[model samples]
Target: MPYSNESHFHPATFILLGIPDLENIYSWLSVPFFIMYVMAVLGNGAMLLIIQTEQRLHTPMYYFLAMLAFTDLVLSSCIMPKLLSIFWFSSTVIYFEACLFQMFMIHTFTSVESGVLLAMAFDRYVAICNPLRYALVLTNPIILWMGIANVIRGVIIVIPCPGMASRLPYCVTNVIHHSYCDHMAVVKLACVDTTVNSVYGLTVVLLVIVFDVIFISVSYAMILRTVYNLPSKAARSKAINTCTAHICIILLFYTLGLFSFLTHRVGHSVAPYVHILLANYYLLVPPVMNPIVYGIKTKEIREKAFKVFYKKV
Candidate 1:
């Protein structure tokens, strides 16, 4: 049996090869992956709950955090069920529209999450460097608009991706090499020249890394300078501590993202399983750790989380 170069002008379904060359061990792998999904859901869900119920967590910082948690929830939820089916039941076929939808949601939410991280950096910068105007600068209406703006940005940036991919002729093979319907993985299966899709995909990755990381880096740099010049040691330590969770999360998120992106293009020598595993972790680990980092590193979140669970504040 051989696949000819038959062009599917409108493919009905595309087959997914979950974690290429690891089909035999998908059941073994699914356990930990499933646990991660559960942890992400519970952790982010709890963050949202605590942020909403607690009166003290109503400020601009917590508002942005709530949005982050919500984004993580959507990100994980969108991919896990279909992915788990592939892992557990060998249900690797996804309808063409569903695959495109998954690609759109994953990329859009990831972009939105990056925007949220950038927004958090801005919040921290204002809180530390411009404390006097924090209240005025970050009003509830302003925070609301920030959330709206991030969503709009994500939608605008990612809408063209699926449209461009859909128009391409996927005539060669329908077997997507990764677990989920990743954008590049889908587009690579196209028979025609995918230069535009390739360039656009690369551009999207570069845009996210360049803009979000640079602004975040700048914000934290100024924050450090302000903290360094604080009048007292105690004040300096407190300011630094306030930003620890955010800094850790930024490092974790971006490092994973950079590696995943590089592997697709430059890391041709990398094993397919290795690349696929990293891609899966890039999406799952951040969601799983965001709540943990915020819970452990942010004192207020830690205390409230414990109080909610044990009734011992």
Candidate 2:
């Protein structure tokens, strides 16, 4: 539906009534969301500390993991507080500038997350397929460059959002269905044509999803071939076990991500709530579960994390 004629909208600014009728659901859902946010913060924080303090985890895999945890911390922080406030205080209104900022941060962190995942896949591929050159291939310089590249990619991909939002005239309804300002959600409110914004957003999604998935698949294929060649059953099993958690994370993130995107574009009314839930899950679940997955599957991280916790106590 086009924007309702409730309020006059401004091109320079817009009032966003966040998540219409959110007050009714806020009281009940806020408690569980608060608990999950706390756990996510603690879990990802502990993982980062363990990786930083432990000498054994100074290698490239753990280095990338540390980066991943940091990204999760950032990604969660960007969205959760505003969501919490909206629930706890029933403050659903957001200013236009603030909305744009939120959208930019969300996209930036999302792009960074994709880049980090791809980097981790490459790390695994090198370790399994070409162990002889693993250390040389994933040197400190290479890892640093990967971090830089991730930041650059995030900035480049999301640069269009604010400009697009700025140009569009919002002369109609301003309520956003979700808690935070999302790219498409904001664009949909625009009174003017949003073809440019939609096209640009779709392009970024394709690059992140299509290009990144292809690279990750290729990396895993090489890793799988190497695993199959291993003579010892124990070695083969161990290698597969090591990759299982990452594979699970990748599947969960991408599947839900694509599903949410598709639903937003194609099947809006019937599955709006489902899309909303999946959108939140796509952002929150990986960060929450990643630590658990790595803690259980990776012996070194598990041991070190416990050791650090005990020492602090």
Best by lDDT: 1
Q: Supply candidate 2's per-residue lDDT for 26.
A: 70
Give the C-alpha lDDT of model 1: 0.91
* Candidate 2 lDDT tens digits, 1-313: 2432344344443444434545577788788778778888999999998888888899999999898899988888877898888777766767677888989999998999888999999988988888899989999999999999998999988978876776676876776777678898888887788898999999999988789999999999989899999999999998888788789778877887887788878875744656776677778878888888889989999888777778889
Candidate 2 lDDT trough over 10 residues, lowest sum:
1-10
lDDT for 57 in candidate 2 is 90
Clash totals for all candidate models:
0, 0
Candidate 1 worst ten-residue window by lDDT: 1-10
User: Which residues of candidate 2, in runs, are more than 4 Å off?
Assistant: 1-22
Best candidate, TM-score: 1
RMSD in angstroms, all models? 2.5, 3.3
